[model samples]
Target: MSQIPPPRRRRALGCGIAATAVALVGIVPTAIVFVLASAMDPNYGWLLFITLPIAVFFGSVALVLGVIGIAFALTDRGGYAWPIVGIALGAAQLIPAAALLTG
Candidate 1:
C-alpha cells in the first residue's frame, strides 16, 4: 500500500476542522437569537431573528477559513486573508444583532 503524503494529511485535517467550525457558526448565533426572541418578544422578534443565523453562518465560514488559511500559509501554502477580515467584520455585527434581538 502507498503511504499518504504528510502535507496532504495536514490539509485534509485543516479543511475538515475549518468546515466544522464554519458549520457551527450558524448554530451558535441562531440559538442565541431563538432563545432571546422566545423570551423577550416571540411575535415580532421572529422577523428580526432572520439576520442572526445568516450572518453567523457566513461570518463563521470566513473566520474558520481565515484561521485555516493562515495555518496553511505558515506551513508554506498561500491563502488570502479575506476570510479572516470577513470574520472580524462579522464579529462586530454580531454584537448589534444580539442587542437588537435581546435588548
Candidate 2:
C-alpha cells in the first residue's frame, strides 16, 4: 500500500517550490539586465541603480521564503530535498545581487 503524506509535508513542499520560483524570478531578470548593461554603452550605467534595487528586493524575498521553507521542512519526518533546493537557489539569487551592490 502507498503511504499518504502529512499536511505539514505538503505545506513544506509548497513553500519550497514557491521559494525556488521566487529566486528564479529574481535571478533571471537581473541576469538579463547585467548582460544588457555590459553590452551597451557606458553612458547607460545609471540604469544599474534601477535594476539593482529591484533585484535586491526580490532576492530578499526569496531568502526569507527559503528560510521559512527550510524551517518548516526540518520539523517533519519527511525528506527536505525541496527546501534544501530552495535555500540553494535563494542563496544563488542573493549572492549576485550582493556582489553587484558591493562592487
Candidate 3:
C-alpha cells in the first residue's frame, strides 16, 4: 500500500504558541508584584521596577505575535485556535503593565 502523506505545516503557529507562552510567563511576576503591592507598603514599590519592564516587554511582544498569528490565520496560513488564545492572553497580560503604572 502507498504511504500516507505527512500533515501540512501551518504558518504562524509558532508565533501563536510563542505569544501564549510569553503571556503566561509574564503573568507570574505580574501576579507576584500585584500580591506584594497589595499586601505591603509603598516602600516595596521598588519591586515594580524589576517586574514592570519584564511584564511590559513580554506583553507587548505577545500582543504583536498574536496579531501576526491572527493575520496569518485570516489568510488561511494557519489555524485559528492558538492565535485567539494568544490574543486574549496577551491582552490580559497587559493589565499588569497598566497596574504597574497606576499603582
Q: Pick the candidate with the highest TM-score.
A: 2
The digit string of per-residue lDDT tens for model 1 on 1-103 reads 9987765335534554565456456556666766778887776466545756586556656566656655665675544344345455546555665677797
**Which candidate number has the best lDDT?**
3
lDDT values, one for every candidate:
0.58, 0.72, 0.80
Q: Where does the lowest 10-residue lDDT sum fall in candidate 3?
A: 40-49
* Descending-TM-score candidate ranking: 2, 3, 1
- What TM-score would every model get versus the actual structure? 0.40, 0.70, 0.70
Candidate achieving higher lDDT, 2 or 3: 3
Give the root-mean-square deviation of each candidate in angstroms.
7.8, 3.6, 3.4
Q: After superposing candidate 2, which stretches have Cα over 4 Å from the reference?
A: 1-8, 39-45, 96-103
Model 3 agreement with the true structure over 45-99: per-residue lDDT tens digits: 6887787778778888888999998898778656888877888887886776687
Error of 1 at 46 (Å): 6.2
Worst 10 residues of 1 by lDDT: 78-87
